[model samples]
Target chain A: MEINHTVIDSVPILAVSGRIDATTSRDLENALNGLIEEDNNRIIVDLAGVEYISSVGLRVMLAALKKVRPKQGDLMLASLQPFVREVFEITGFTKLFLICPDQREAISKMKTG
Target chain B: MMGINREITVPARLGEIPAISDFIYEVMSACGFDAKKIMEMQLAAEEACTNISNYAYEERNGQIHITAAAEDDLHLTLEDWGTPFDPTSRIAPVTESPAEERPIGGLGIYLIKNCVDEIHYQHRDGKNILKLVKNKD
Candidate 1:
């Protein structure tokens, strides 16, 4: 997996590509942890390029969410492909995170909070 | 039985998951599963294989052998010589639980159960065999 980091209105946006499974989830966890440790609490993950995710991937996201929420920060997800989106839906994660149709919307939501 | 059959064995390690997934995707695609069904089958197979890679071999090195066949439905069997475990026996997580109360583990098997049409587990000859079947129609 590859993650490209950028800042949108001070919120870190991670544009992730490739698959996120048991083997690749650590890369994502490390990226997100680095951002969290840097005090970049508000974050956005762009999944437009991600083709697959398993429970391991979901665990990383959930851990990040738990870490950030306490600080009044948020981790948002955007541009989820149909299959990826379905994983979230089936796991009931759609109710937990602010998932947007695109980066602009996700960033907009982050800005409001 | 369908005429198509393919089998592969890979080291029971996390790094090998993609290769396993690719194999499943190729076979399932040839079996006439659409993109969505293919993705679901891939996810289910990956979950089962990941469990084997993580827990089956303990600290010792081991390998997982997978066989896939298709007729009216797609069938995948994962065999490993790891510790005996039944994934079907694990209870499903509470999907309605709040995120804070949710547990990290257990979602893998839950996903496998939900994505595939049927799953069967057996242990014989010191091998843990997991079979997953999904309808192509």
Candidate 2:
């Protein structure tokens, strides 16, 4: 998978493209780790380019969340496809993170809330 | 004589995930599954294969051996030499928590179990094998 990241008003925005499965999940983990190292506690993962996501992907996200929580930061999600949303709901992750309809909304919510 | 079981194996590299998912979809479709079933099976297979690639090896790259069979039913087995954790035995993702409180780690296994008709796991001969089956009428 290809991951493009940028800093938007102090928040690290990771725009992920490709299928996030068992094999490519580590790349994601590495990306998250980089963010953590940078002390960018507030994160927004844009999944608009992500065609698919699996449990390994979720696990990576969980690990990242755990890492950021101690620092009093949060990971948010935006623009999930229907199929990806279904998996999140099935696993109860729809409740674990702040999910927004789009990247702008996620960024706005992070700024305001 | 009975025909031999046909199989295909691919290396479990990060770049090969899409090919693996597509292969599983093709195998399920060839077994007469409808488009919806094929997509579901594909997602489940993708989840399992991705896990193998992500957690099976720490330093050295290892192969994820995938064997797909279509006869009386559809079977997709993924074998890896990584850690010996069985995803099938994992607890379901927390369901009672709200979107902001629920954890994120168990969604893949949950999706796999929910999408497939049958699923099993075994660690034997120093390999972790995840077997999934889907039947069609």
Residue A83 in candidate 1, Cα distance off native in Å: 0.7
Which residue ranges in model 1 land beyond 4 Å of their true spot? B93-95, B98-105
lDDT of 1 by residue, B18-106 (tens): 89888988888777788888889889988887778666776468999999888789889999999997888874666577634533336
Return the TM-score for each candidate structure: 0.93, 0.71
Candidate 2 structure quality by residue, lDDT tens digits, B68-128: 7777677788888888868876646545744334233245566788888899999999999
True lDDT of residue A53, candidate 2: 74
The sequence of per-residue lDDT tens digits that candidate 1 reaches over residues A16-98 is 99989888899999999999999988999999999889988998999999999999999999999989998998888899899
- The stretch of ten residues in a row with the least summed lDDT in candidate 2 chain A is A50-59
User: Cα deviation of A70 in candidate 1 (Å)?
Assistant: 1.5
- Highest lDDT among the candidates is held by which one? 1
